[model samples]
Target chain A: MSVTSLDPVRSELLAELQQKVERIQSGPTAEPVATHPALSGLLQLRAGGVYGVDAASAALLLAAGPSLAGAWCGIVGVQDLGVEAAQTYGLQLERTIVVPEPRERWLEVVAALADVVDLVLVRPPGPVRQGEAARLAARLRKRGAVLVAWGEWPRCDARLTVAGTRWEGLEQGHGRLKARRVRLEVRRGAAPPRERELWLPAADLAVRPVEAEQVRRVEAVPDPVRVVS
Target chain B: MSVSPPLRTMTVWCPDWPVMAALEELRPDAPVAVLENNVVLACSPAARVDGVRRGMRRRDAQARCPELVLAPSRPDADARAFDAVLEAVEELSPGVAPLRPGLCALRVPTRFYGGEAEAAAVIAERIVSLGVWDVRLGVADGLFAAEQAARRAAPQDVVVVPTGGSGDFLADLPVEVLDDPELVSLLRRLGLSSLGAFARLPQSDVHTRFGTHGALLHRLASGGDPHPISRRQPPPELVAALALEPPLSLVEPIAFSLRTTAERFVADLAGHGLVCTAVRIEADVDGVVSSSRRWAHPRWFGTADLVDRVRWQLTAQPAHGPVEAVRLVPEVVEPLGDHADALFGPGADEQVERGVARVQSLVGHDGVVAPSVQGGRGPASRRALVTWGERADGVRPAARPWPGQVPAPAPATVYREPFPALVVGAEDQVVGVDGRGGISCPPARFRAQQGDPWQRVAAWAGPWPVDEQWWDEAAARRVARFQVVGVDGSAWLMVVENGQWWTEARYD
Candidate 1:
């Protein structure tokens, strides 16, 4: 039968199902979210998998791309988050949901939010059991939502950790804090961790790959000073 | 013969009805004045004793009655209170015409009740039984003359104008009764002090000067008040109620029983070409209101949405006893044609709303919230959270320039409550900054938090002074903040207030 002959509702439903079947055959159950420019070569966030980060800023950075691209986001269990920092990182506050204290309903909240939002960032209060995490993982796959866990989660598809750091533009008592340089290490399934140095957030509050010249300039300062008496 | 005669009408009047409605919020005997646009619309009888009158300026009324309690005028409340009175009268005599809140008219039931006065007595008795004590009735040949007669009737009494006597009855009344202020003032200035004088003017002259409105008033003054009553059709039964005969206590079964009522409620609204966006859900136990709340939606509500809201309300706070009854009342409704999505069908917003509703049900009403950045100097103070689906209002503007705010590249993790930390100078002495921002000694090594091991600070900055709300001793704070980098590259924002240190936030 011709597509024009089908009722509008049936045609729309068929179109949605067709897209899903095509996605399954294409090897990924869900599509990838928008990735930050600095992380273009380093990471691609895929739906149905958990991404782990050691620090809160890394988690915000990971969620920022999809949020800026107009996808709704939810943040759970990270209390008193620096809202100014989140905005600077490109997370649209208007579309963000924050569940500061989920307490006992931690799993239930994330599962419910995953059914709607394209990305959800959660910080669990305690250690997770294998069975519960697997159950949540299955829910994520069914809903095609990405989960970014700030803390621990078993069987994570990838883990991003901030390995090293350096701060510039400060003396014993004179100048103020200006910029930071972080060495990021990415670990994926059964592969050696890849290390990269980048300006996690430069002076302008922009995250990008650090240059060789800027690294030397930061190291130029000779020593940690003692306040001259 | 071309113009039909006016019907015999009975007007029921409630004196100072607006003031009576305002009394619901105040003591019964207190002198109250209802004001609209700074002008007194009505005053209680107690205030009238002190010379408070209608149309008095706010200041003038206050001058007359120093102890006057002012109430904001609400016409909707007045109309709502009057609805019960209209319904009572309608039970005795159908085809009632509502002139306004506090007053109504209907065709007199002369034959069935034996006489006009007896009909008036029956209606007045019915109204008095409904708790309205100050009601009077009047019978006449036309709407205007009947209303005027009702005003003259004593409380709980009936005033009947004899047939063809409306003209003589109205001749002696003052011209001020004409409802229009501008035209009445003009007539008063022309020395037409009584309705008789205004009615004596040539009808053609009144028409040429006052146009249609003046001619109509002239007709009223002449006893041939041409205005006819158009009776109001009773409002449709829109409230849907269900009785749980055995009184089910569980939320699910109660929700199940209420599904039909909810569906009927939506269908009823749709039958009238309306969609309810906000609804008031009430559950009763043993004839007492146990739970009541008004749930609002960002978009129009459907059958399933109403069910979910009812279920959530019950789950959040269960009634003290088993629920015996449930009701759904539409609060805010709009025309169905206003749906912006008619072309594309239901959008993703409805789906998102359903998901959020599930989360709200799990954690209780205030569990899920939408966040936005607001103006403040501290990280915690900058974030405002409104319950999801609620419009964010009264939040501080983020566009203001908040001086002394921590510079850009704000920390990623802000502690909801600042945690105690130790920042020591040389020789492990705790660091302190004097009131003048002079550091006693430089911080050499510090612990980000108590449990974390001490590490040498590779780089450190200020005693940037933050002194706020000094006039309020309880809220006054004098603090010094510093950014310190650990050897491992973790950075922390710490504050030293009154010589005690606390970690405020962390930069990844």
Candidate 2:
């Protein structure tokens, strides 16, 4: 679908993804990650900004590409992030590490991870204090790591909200749930927001950009001439 | 230039180090023997007093000392524990050269402590303070003479050869001191009972009779080093420093603060076209260096790996005081080009390494695992899972030809904990396998537990009998595996043993 026609969530995600791409492109390295061009911008985690993601599925959709393309990604304190679904999204299970819960040491844990992990997907157990968030942001920047927050994060570089979702495989409750289409809204730092629609999990378990189908010509009236008149 | 003997080298020897390390956690006075291939390799003094000796068969040794605490020879364990001794020696000297797990050498620092004898006493005192009561220190012109002097010294003592007197000192020693059975026996047959006799043989005659080994032995007996010391290149100028503000008390904060420094440390190594295989980390609590440790990495330390080591070192214990400064030193480095990228190009999954590392840090190291295939007949036993950054210890060799292993197309999912299930026939009776490896009935339904509804089984295969460790009654298992496909397209490998059914693995 056209970027504007996407539901709010997808538009926001698209705008954020585009802003990352623009920033990476303007820098010395035009192409940040060479393996997965589809995830080039998403993997170039700019320092000092916490980027928010709306759903685990949407997060995996953005993550799987870069993860498979050699970027180290971690899910911290995200209890229900399914390893199986993550594998389906093309992530090599061998390389993925999931920390379901990090209670009191959440900030320290994230900071330690920021040193090594290229991208960290965190679900803050509670609202983080301003100073704590700022400290985390500064660490990420210095370490050149990206923090992908599952919940709202203050002063985020970008935010992607999942607006709508549709599953294609279920046939009246008989068939299994399979392919999923999601609309993502992207809001980047001071950039005009945009949208994108994608298969959150394509038939083959890879995220794919969705293209609008060509509008077919139809006759509203019984006769074309009558309709014209 | 005047021909001069090699500089005097000091040797520190820890007798029966493997036995000592093996019994480190055990009673200090226990009689112990370390075995290799069922033969005694080394034994404690108590075992020796009990008539147990090295080279004795396991049975013979046990007969000699029934209460001997026998242990397998663990070279790696010995080396790992001996790191403490190395560190202790390193505290006294900067250029320590480790000869083996129990022995090390360093140039005698006569100027620092007045003379070689005083230098030996200083080192012995340092090691004794570290709780190694039986340390022996020896100083001589060559490494061999020094090692021999250390071996002959009484426990908790030092032996120093007078300057340029190693040749005179080694003359009367038995030829067996060389420890080469063939040479010793041959020399004895030739009526040469001492090193002096062997050394007196014409150099050309010794070369003609005993070849290179004999010539080398002659040189050693005449007070020459086996090989001239090739001094190492001075350690590279690579140190990353971080000065903490207000000195951090918590390990996590110290680790967090040093993240940038660690990254720069790795980057600096990379800039010099080098990769560090081993690194030394030092934290200054106050003005003086408080804690220092050397860490070896399985792979060259990347930015994250270096940071992980720093965190591990810091968190291993809470510092007595706030950490004021931290420094990273590359202990061992290799040329960057030595590690050729994979021929097919790097795997896109390098990100998963970071993920695994992060999870390990949060969960305290054992939280995340990568599954590996290993040799075994059972579905659960065939899969080996290893925590990240650790070697797959205890894994059965997958290369061996296991006669009755479960045939592949291996299961997609192996339950970490097997689930008990009911395999029933049409009559609602539980399906089972008899002792003769025959099925009691065809499985028609499968239910996980009593309350769960029985799901219709679509297709079935196997009843493959696996009788493992039949001779070991307590460890024996007799099971028949059946691959049953459910109506929902899910397939499971179920086992029937001792009238019990278990869901072992799943195919997704």
Candidate 3:
């Protein structure tokens, strides 16, 4: 009701809001998430390293991180694992494009995927020539979609590499046994990505940190009955 | 009555009675006896010679005959085969009803077959042609009197009961012609062993013992009611198909195929002037099959309606993929008049066909259906939603009356496949063990996917137990079922026994 005078509670609230505004202005701004130019486009992969691509990691990056819902993605692989994982994650996968023997029809499958799908996840056939990889990358870029290559890429705007390491000491069973774990090294854009050591649980698709009791083994002892007689 | 011709009834008796000599056919070198309805209905005269009387046990007949030919009575088979003999006799008389395997009652117009004696001769000739081993023809004013007269006649004789004289003719015959053992016993007890004495009894007492049957007996004894002859037409043929490929994932292809087949089938029926009134579609998956809705359309057969029936069939099919094929068939057809059009207006059938095709494409072949009547003794058996072409015979009477069964009114929707159940605390040992080291109570908790956590049992009923059918040996299951409510507002039908617990069903 008072026009000119600021109450103590209102003044305090204003002071708190101003500090938050200043803090936001001084902090680093997050990068904008990339968007596909078309609702449906294809992602193509060159031979070799593309075939060994990690479909789960690519799916997580596309789905769980930024664009969560209604994001359509396609995975093309010689093996079924990548396509299957993508399906389990609930991505709308059109079809898996398989390159038959003689390998001449590989290009046709890639073209079909490009015409129908928005994002194409590709596992290429073995290794590819630098020219071939670069050509495919260019085609994907023209489609206005990013290609997150897993294994090896001859030419690409950004690259992420993964290295595996053995982990020691982890709990197993009903917390009654010991086991070893695995550590992974992630590299991104010419810089080494963070290296994280994690335990692999007995459950499917579950990864956890190694616990102390897992690596220990129990020993057997001899029976002690006959000495008394 | 004076102008109308008299009705003549005739009966033929086997003469040589080769059925008597055929006893050796059943048993090697053994005398055989024939029995009907578990009475000594007939005996090989050879068996009669061996001291096996008409009322002897099969064992005694065998003992008396030494080597006895035994034949199990097949009343239905005998009656069916006897129809050929009746058909031959009908050439001489329009009215013929076979009263027994070896007996027939015929009503022939006197002018049609010359006269009563000529008609009798013609019937006797036809009976002889049937390879009956012997023949006797008796013509009378009515059926019962004629049958008794024929039985008393010689192997080749013709006996006739005069018009308006059947009552006098039947007076001296034995009381067994009534075919009632109780009546015969009562007559024997009353010292009225002959038809004449039984007919003399007051109608009131006869009716008192047997009600209407006794009255009918009295009338028959007095040669009263005329035997009305009724003929039954043959049952119609049923033609159905089974699809080789189960339309599990694709409905469009199945629907298209079904519509085309149905149209072609209906077109084939055009010559018969018959239009199908009801069509059933059966969708078969693995070993289990589901029927589609039965369609009863007023317009007879329409391609669009047929396609819709198929679409309903496919939609009703279980979502699981094991279906091998779908079969569409019209169950009932009625004659269509010439006024009915051959086909419906253009685009009408097509629109319905397209809609069905679309539904089949979205669902499976079994999803589309029409309502059908299922036959069974119980409430669940009366009606079913069967596929358009499926046989609606799945209505099975419940094994026992389950007044409070889980499916009261039966669920309109049941999952095609039973979902896998997860058991909690199922492996835990019971606190107190029985002498045999088995747990007396089942596990305390159970859970399903994304369902609430285990809750303590609140109010519960059963372990109303069921044991596997031991006689079957193969299908016996030792299961104790209980209904429990969990803490998280879930009701489950659980079964535990023989060291394991399983959630049988859920009320969600």
Question: What TM-score against the true fold does each predicted structure earn?
Answer: 0.56, 0.56, 0.34
Regions more than 4 Å wrong, model 3: A1-229, B1-6, B12-30, B35-39, B204-210, B232-508
Candidate 2 on B1-508: residue-level lDDT in tens?
9986557788999998889887787888899999987889899989999999888999999898988888878776677667888888777776778788899888888888898778878888888888888899888888899999999898978888887888888999999999889999999999999998888888899899889988999889877777543333456789889999899888877777778898888888888888887888888876888888988663478878877877888778556798899899888777776554523554334423543554465567655555445678876776565555665556788789887776544443466667799887878788878878667777777775456556776567767788899985668988888777655445567888888988887643
lDDT of each: 0.84, 0.72, 0.50
How high is each candidate's interface RMSD, in Å? 4.9, 14.3, 20.8
Best TM-score goes to which candidate? Answer: 1
User: For residues B1-508, could you state the per-residue lDDT of candidate 1 as single tens digits?
Assistant: 5876546999999998989898877888899998988899999989999999999999999999999998877676688789999989989888998888999999998889999999999999999998888999999998888999999999999899998999999999999998889999999899999999999999999999999989999999999967778987655778889999999999999888888888899999999888887799999998999999998765678889988998999999899999999999887776776654544764455556656876787887678888888877766667688777765655679889988777767788788889999988878899888878888888888888876777788778888888777885667877888988866667888998878899998886
What local lDDT does model 3 show for residue B287? 57
- In terms of docking quality, model 2 is incorrect
Best by DockQ: 1
Instruction: List the candidate 1 regions with Cα displacement exceeding 4 Å.
Output: A1-28, A212-229, B1-346, B390-394
Better of 1 and 3 by TM-score: 1
Chain B TM-score for all candidates, comma-separated = 0.53, 0.64, 0.45
lDDT of 2: 0.72
What is the Cα root-mean-square deviation between model 3 and the actual structure? Answer: 24.5
Worst 10 residues of 2 chain B by lDDT: B346-355
